[model samples]
Target: MANIEFFDRTMLEAMSLLAESRRYLTDKAEAESQKMDLEQGLANSMETMRLVARLTQVLAWLLTHRAVHAGEMSIAEATVPDRRLGGRDLCAKDSSDAAKTLPDELQSLLSRSHSLYLRIARLDDQATARAEINTKVSGGPRPQ
Candidate 1:
């Protein structure tokens, strides 16, 4: 199906991005931050962690669906909302002037992660709504 193709392609891109971001955080970003003074370095470090956290949550959601596509996870098992985004409280960085001067790489990665998270959240919402509708149409118990 076309959606299966979409799923495969999305997973490939997401996983590739995960690897690239992990490498940057562990190697490049760390070293680059060390060049800053203490307070600025700590702020950079916090932003780095936030970016990584967002990416990790997105990866978890992607991997869960990958398992479903592989027939290793039931649709019901995958529908749990808590499992979707790990229930992480999103605290997006401020939009003030101080925030505008972040490194280009961090800005790019942060923007990408935000986009991916929103996309996944929308897909999850659509899937859940579809499941509820299917259940209703089939005279099965409606989703609670």
Candidate 2:
């Protein structure tokens, strides 16, 4: 299905970006972190956490959708609050001023992860809306 293809593409992109971010964070960023002043170092650490959180949320949502597509999870199950896209308060928060001074690679990772999370959040909202509409139309789930 067209929607499946979209998710597949998105999943691949997220995976690629996540891997790149990990490499940069574990290698270059870790080394550069020691060179920063206390304030900047704290900012870098916080931003790094934000970046990881964004990607983790994105990946989790994508995997849930993937499970639904694979028939491993019902649409209703995936729409549940616990399974839905989360971390909006933190993941969607704007980067701090001090974060702007972080390494170029880290800044780029934060930007990319934020953008990806926003896109996936939109998808989650759309999917949940559609599920609600279907439930309304069918007058709730039938016996299974």
Candidate 3:
């Protein structure tokens, strides 16, 4: 019950952060207006993409667990590969050096999103491990 509440709080917070970041990006000045060089512009784009991807992954994973809790999805189903947390390769990568020049809000969003993604990824791993152990104990088919 506590885990569910914790994830619920985290999900709401992540959603709010995602919305705020979106608004900031939408209202932000164009790269040229900010006098960003080509490299800086590219870095900004990449970091922005990473930020969105990270949050999207977090939301999807949270929603999956939410469904399980709601009885709309089984725990076994949620642990499946397709339903598991994703975008690790992209979301886990370090922000580019040029991304350091981005606006402070953007930097903070990036940091927070990355941290949240990592936290959820750890949970995902733990879930997978538990599912694997359950399969072994039950002599059931292994998780794909």
Best model per TM-score: 2
* Poorest 10 consecutive residues by lDDT, candidate 3: 29-38
lDDT of 3 by residue, 30-85 (tens): 64336777777778888888998998899999989989889997677789999899
Stretches off by above 4 angstroms in model 3 are 29-34, 96-98, 142-144
C-alpha lDDT of all candidate models, in order: 0.70, 0.87, 0.84
lDDT tens readout by residue for model 2, 18-83 = 999979987798789999999999898899889989999999999999998999987777888888
RMSD in angstroms between candidate 2 and the native structure over all alpha carbons: 2.3
lDDT of 2 at 30: 74
**Model 1 per-residue lDDT tens digits across residues 1-144:** 888899888778777778878877777886777678877777777667767777777778788888878899755567666665653465243322443556777767767766776677777777677766666777866423
Q: What clash pairs does model 3 have? A: none
In terms of lDDT, the best-performing candidate is 2
- RMSD in order of candidates: 2.9, 2.3, 1.9
TM-score of 2: 0.92
Q: How high is each candidate's TM-score?
A: 0.79, 0.92, 0.90
Query: What lDDT does candidate 2 reach at residue 64?
Result: 93
For candidate 2, the lDDT comes to 0.87
